[model samples]
Target: MNNSKKANYSIKCTVENCANHCGKEQYCSLDCICVGTHEGNPTMDQCTDCKSFLLK
Candidate 1:
């Protein structure tokens, strides 16, 4: 028998007002996140934002 657990990335986040924020650790509790752009296309990093962000 094998007993193991999958690793979950501890993503450091600064969005304090976001619902995913992990208390005072400044980390995101969500297993994964989604990013989307308002232009319907992405050509630059600034063109995207965390669509998963939910106001606390």
Candidate 2:
């Protein structure tokens, strides 16, 4: 069995209030993140938002 851990790169995030936001670094430390929105058939970037967002 492979015991090696997968590599995860930091994602640049500007939302400071998000729980996953790296302090002052503008990056997310989380290995991965989920994104979603309230409406269906989204057409723009604004239509999509972070589903993993957590209040700071």
lDDT of 2 by residue, 1-56 (tens): 11232323457788777766766566776788898887788888999988878887
Cα lDDT for residue 55, candidate 1? 89
Report the poorest 10 consecutive residues by lDDT, candidate 1.
1-10
**RMSD in angstroms between candidate 1 and the native structure over all alpha carbons:** 7.8
What TM-score does candidate 2 get on C-alpha atoms? 0.75
lDDT of 2: 0.70
Provide the lDDT at 31 for model 1: 86
Name every residue pair that clashes in candidate 2. none
Question: What's the true lDDT of residue 15 in model 2?
Answer: 79
| Candidate 1 residue pairs in backbone clash | none
Q: Indicate which candidate wins on TM-score.
A: 2
As a whole number from 0 to 100, the lDDT of residue 3 in candidate 2 is 21
